[model samples]
Target: MDRVKGKTAIVTGGATGLGFAIARRLEQEGAKVIITDVDVTRGKEAAGEIGGLFKQQDVASENQWISLIEQVRGEFGKLDILVNNAGISGPVQNADPESTSTDDWERIHKVNGLGVFLGCKHAIDLMRQSGGGSIINMSSIAALVATPFITAYGSSKAGVAQFTRSVALYCAQSGSKIRCNSVHPGQIRTEMHDSLLDETAELMGASRDDVENDFKSRIPMGYFGEPVEIANMVLFLASDEARYITGGKFIVDGGMELGG
Candidate 1:
């Protein structure tokens, strides 16, 4: 864990949920961390609790990315890790391809797809100067399996997977020490889950308990994964421990992706 001591990292959407968990893990591993998110209140609270810096950033905004990297460079001097974790599920119940509007699709793509692209695009420059870095793009199980209900969500994640691979190869071909990888997670209990639970229950015409049970049953582990578990995987990849790993997709879904 001390391998990351004195290293600097940035976790996007680090205010809460999986992002916050990753930030805390990176800090615990001795990395000087900065977390960015649009949620000012929660972002500041999480940063204060973790003893890291928090900045307001809308991942979908291309213009802000330049400023963001500059800010990090000025304060931290170098960037060793970049976690592209800020994403939205996109208009929940209406996420079906046919049912989804152009606006919804564009918005989701902006954050989930373009955001990761821009993050890596800017990060590589700073990282190359520092000799090397790791980029972890947060994908979802939806990227691999077809989730009939949330079309936009699935499409955006699919884009993330490919983008991660493309960047990895680019870095390799360029002879840069930087690495890029994607982490696909299954359902984890978070505020985002709370927002969808009732609606999802209604959509499936099942009780909330039944929906929760159904999700758990899908995982061979018989339980939902903790965000920290995913965080641990990311921490390893961001550290020298995974120096030889790149362009790989790590699925932390507890066997949910086994069947279909």
Candidate 2:
């Protein structure tokens, strides 16, 4: 309760799944949250539910990023936290390096890679004006491991992880109090995960249950993770309790990354 009281936060892709959960958590902890997503209707509904604000945004657009930060500055007078959670995995098939087309690769990178970069870039400027803040970029286990099936998404997330470190170092070296870190979630039970399951099932000509079981078997924990679990980590990072933590990679992956 009140972990981030009086703070102002912007959560990208907050209309659903992990994003929505993160926004709700921040709002619940007393932050003034703004939920941004391309899905205007859902985004508004989500914001209303959480007693926060909503902004329609295509994160890939630099103009929109600029406008969003300006809006935050005008309304809140300062921005304290940013969760760069918006990203796209694209179609499961044709995602491999050999099968992926240039268009498909670029599309995934545009949203997953460039979006986070832009968010961090603009958020830093606003945060620096207001005595600095925390930036949490959502990476994934795919970034840590080889994801031959999702080459573009995996590569984009890997870029996010590395870029987060760079952002943290730059802010620190420049004497900015801003902190940057990446959160990598593994097999979270979200709509995106369900969709991936369905697609993988089809691609492998296997039953959904079999595909799901196969995925579960890969995890040492033997189950999917919940959204709130990831949200809690973000909350911790957003709070002053983690003031000394920067340029870190927090893996909330249920030990899946350890690889049984």
RMSD of each: 1.0, 0.7
lDDT of each structure? 0.91, 0.95
lDDT of 1 by residue, 1-260 (tens): 68688899999999999999999999998999999999999999999999999989998787889999999889888999999999998656777867888988888898999999999998899999888999999999999999777798899999999999999999999988999999999878888876677788987788999888877887888888899999999999999999999999999988889965
Off by over 4 Å in 1: none
Native-to-model Cα distance after best TM-score fit, residue 60 in candidate 2, in Å:
0.7
**Global fold similarity of model 1 (TM-score):** 0.97
- Candidate maximizing lDDT: 2
TM-score of each: 0.97, 0.99
Worst 10-residue lDDT window for candidate 2 reads: 251-260
